[model samples]
Target: MADVYDTTYGQADYFGSEASPLLARYADWIPAEARVLDIGAGQGRNSLPLARRGCRVTALEPSGVGRAAIKAQAAEAGLDLDIVGENFMSYEPRGVFDVILCFGLVQILRYQECASLVTRLHQWLRSGGTLFLTAWHVGDPSFARLTREWERLGIRSFRSPDGSQYRLFLEDGEILKLFFRWQTIHHCEGLGPEHRHGDGPPERHGEIEVVLTRP
Candidate 1:
């Protein structure tokens, strides 16, 4: 995975310097001094902004390059960001966080892995803490291509166009089902323009954006 990101991060601006609009939109849900865990926090896109907002952020990333970029950006901004170079699956939470960011990661894991990860995340959040997530859904136009490949291979995972990466796409209600034990604050799934990672043409995707609070 590190090798994959090392190449991707080097080739394209997948993790932008600025915070994503999704994160910014829900920033108020996080208190001024809240503790935040940013899983798959590549290059501090969300971490830096949350830190600037007075949140103490712990950024967990798998790639060394990504972690280095995040550290450098945090330093340039003179912000204190706890950047951890580790995969989230093997990472042990030190303490409960007031808010957890899991953007653009759920769709990459196997079905069971996604289930287990969310279950662990539920335990990692404090009562009433928020978990924000974004993932590709079956409604996206890309879903048809991925589904065809999955059916051909008889597996849930689909390889990237270059065959260097594999990702999973969820269907309707999957996200809600995963967090059925929690209180859903917001959930939306529909067609949306894909993030332009590199100078590629803008494409449409079936995507799901969700915010849930642990009870």
Candidate 2:
């Protein structure tokens, strides 16, 4: 059974116009026809399109709500996708994929677990495979305040079904350093407090986008 945190799936759209930019950048590195793994996938936003384009897609979402959303959207789009409601720290890939996405996942665990996950994700990729990641940057003042509030509320350390706590924030160098074993293709530090469709952006929630490839 999923925990309280699991219910918060698909809360916000992290990527709006930037989705195209990330996809285009990924296309340049990943093969035209590739198997993609969307770790922490929510609602099949990016996964659905990739599957529609003829790529084999496997979305790994730990949240039941998130996984159900993936399936729901996949059917709505008529996109074939394999859904696995498994935690990232314990998720063993069936095989290496051409592209692996870790978007909006780094801050979802402890600092050490996050580090191990990056290394494991890199290992799960096939040679020349690409890994894309985006996370809320810790430098954002608004997010800092939010984290403090969540902590103050005594939910600072809520446990998930997988025994992991949820608090998402990452440093710039820590994110950039994930490419130590892989070659970096693209990296961006676009500050946004959650803006989609000219929503004029919010006051908090900025993210950093990263794309790296295994050699």
Candidate 3:
């Protein structure tokens, strides 16, 4: 049920609390009437606010649950939104955007997907366009030990409380090293304990925040 499209889609309902400093910082990157793409946009947490700011937003989410959430929000606000119910990897954009907000969904993808996604994102971004991304970061020796134990057991997927299979790949420097084609203008690792909600149990999985731009 957790990983299925119906349950997996709209997060805007519960993720209202997930908005943190990272989102606040990314919001500044959005200009008035900017064209924004909210990839893995679950329920319009950032999308709703961005729309209210007068920005033209396209909310892309694969989960029906997520699509419904964004639909409800946009309808109530009378905001014009283009919602695409498809995977970010396969969806083709007709034009470039001014800013792309990719919050909280990076690790959901495998490393291979990240490579292609990075390229596609760059291709769809206009000159000097900005991209904001967040990823779950591995910090602390305790997490290292636990993950190592899992690896030793040859268990690749972590099962969450909701019976969903969540997988994570990148550790720390891997994402930057792999996706370095774009210039990183702003970077920061999230503060506090880790947060392994998607990858496994709802444990601590610290994060990395990156603001990149094309040359």
Candidate 4:
């Protein structure tokens, strides 16, 4: 999986350079010196922007290529970011964070792994900390296609024919169940903005977006 992303990051802008719009949508809640953890922080898209805002950011990316890009960009911009070239499973966090960003991550894991990560998130966040997450859901247009072409691993999990890709699409409000104790700051589900990747034509995902805060 790491190699796959390393190749992708080396070859193209798999995820565009722009930061996620969620940042602007919830800017008031994140302080300038807030400690941030950007899980799966691919190529520093969100990490760089948060750092530029004077937030203390820890960008975790398993792909070496992605980490290098982040380091280069941060150095060029004279920003100091804590870049971790470790996947979530192997990396152990040192302290609690004021904010955690999980973008384009959940779908790649199985149900149990995703749930486990959610448990860890609760423990890793400071009281009143915020979490921003996004994932593809079962209602996605691609889900039907993937169900037909791929091997079903679970109720919502699928593996591609070549076995190079795996996905676990969420059920509507499925993630909310995991964080039921938290306060919901924002929640939306449906098709996401159009995007193009690696010579592929424009496409949009059936995405679930949520922002929550621990009590």
The Cα local distance difference test for each model comes to 0.81, 0.69, 0.70, 0.89
- Using lDDT as the measure, name the better of candidate 3 and candidate 4: 4
lDDT of 3 by residue, 70-187 (tens): 8887898798889988888889988999988888776655555666888888788898888888776666233455464433222322333444434454566666775567788777
lDDT of 4 at 187: 91
Model 3 residue 52 distance off true place after TM-score fit, in angstroms: 0.9
Summarize candidate 1's per-residue lDDT along 72-158 as a digit string, tens digits: 877888999899888777899889999999988877776667778877888899999999999987776866777655432324457
- Top TM-score hit: 4
- Highest lDDT against the true fold, candidate: 4
Candidate 4: 10-residue stretch with minimal lDDT: 10-19
Worst 10 residues of 2 by lDDT: 152-161
Candidate 3: pairs in clash: 9-66, 10-65, 10-66, 194-204, 194-205, 194-206, 195-204, 195-205
- Candidate 2 Cα outliers beyond 4 Å, as residue runs: 9-21, 146-165, 193-201
Candidates 1 and 3, the one with greater lDDT: 1
Predicted candidate 3: what Cα RMSD to the true structure? 4.2
Better of 1 and 4 by TM-score: 4
Model 1 residue 189 CA deviation (Å) reads 0.6
After best superposition, candidate 4 residue 42: deviation in angstroms? 0.4
State the lDDT at 65 in candidate 2: 73
